[model samples]
Target: MTTLFYRKIYAMKTADSTEFYVVRHGQTAANLQARIQGQQDTLLDETGELQVNCLAEFLKDAKFDIVYVSDLKRTRATAAAIMQYHPDTPVFFTPELREWHLGALEGRSFAELNAAYPLLMQQIRQSSFDAAPPEGESMLQFQERINRFMEKIASEHPNQKILLVTHGGVLQRIFNLAVGVVGSGNLRPLCHNASLSVFQRRNAQWQLAVWNNTSFMHLTSANDTITL
Candidate 1:
């Protein structure tokens, strides 16, 4: 196990700053297998379980005002660890925050995907955020859904510290939204298991305080790629 010293995301919360502690869930069985989990629910694997302990220890004292997670086992497991410390914190799930449905590609690996469906794979490789896999929703559809979710949260829980436990795919969308990132085929950091990203909105502008943070991963494998 690796060890990392973490600083509080928001050392001190202010009345005007709305802070979000957005986290991608820990490692999963699918991740180890190099398969796409998509919206298919899977619980945390053995390593993921230990990763949760490190995550919880890092966040136990943030005292988030509320917690939100996608209605998926991996994320739920991570959120559960935090709840053990913040026993009184309210935690809930929403389907919209789940992973981007990978459709027919679910369970398939990138290596086979490249060989089996070269054209489709090309589209994916091109960063076709608006393109969808067979039987999947397009990136446009996914982004719109995420936008609505963000709006609802900001409106409902203004000026509060919030914890969002969700998939790496959704986290990508949230990160893109946060950075006004547009277009395809751009370089973006990989989201890691049990990683955290911090965001704040001021004057209607979103600012990324952190990104793809695996500071806590010092407790677990640093190479587990929670791919989007």
Candidate 2:
């Protein structure tokens, strides 16, 4: 994983209203095999179930007024586990929060895709700012939708604590939006499975205070959440 930034636990008055947690969905069978899921309705494997369960335990004390989840099974399962702790928090679903649609390359492995679309793959390897995978959404399309979603969240939930259970692709956009670079290049923070990231709305600006943090989980159980 890229160590581009460090984690700082930001704390504010209990009355602070603009705080949210972005959690990546847990591991899936495709993830273990190194295949791209791309909006696939893949179920969480046994490991995923365990990962979210542990995460839910760690967040048992957290208070969220609302929860948002991608319209995918993996994210839904993960959110359900966490919602167990926050029974009163209402969960909402939206396609805008789904992962990058891979289209024809949905179930392909990285190596297979590299061999097939060598140049295009390499160009987008670092940043997926301008690559189209068969019938997949273009970079422009992806950016537009994500920016719209970000705007909605910022506008709708002021000074309220919320949670988003989504894919790594969506989480990357959150990082980009925080730094005021929504669709420049492939500028995104590494988001681990079931990892928790945090942001705050201070002075009317979004700050990416925490990136890819899983310290809430026990050391042993957290091993599955990280990538090599």
Candidate 1 lDDT tens digits, 191-226: 778878888766667667777766665554523732
Q: In candidate 2, what are the lDDT values of residues 1-228, reduced to their tens digit?
A: 432344444454235447878889988999999898898899988777778887788788887878889989999999999998888888899888999887888888989999998976775565667777788886657767787887788679877888889988888777777788844366756677888887777666778767787665563465555442
Which stretches of candidate 1 lie above 4 Å from their native place? 1-8, 219-228
Off by over 4 Å in 2: 1-10, 13-17, 219-228
TM-score of 1: 0.88
In angstroms, the error of model 2 at 196 is 0.3
Clashing pairs in 2: 17-159, 17-160, 18-159, 127-186
Q: CA lDDT of 174 in candidate 2?
A: 76
Candidate 2 versus truth, CA RMSD in Å, comes to: 2.7
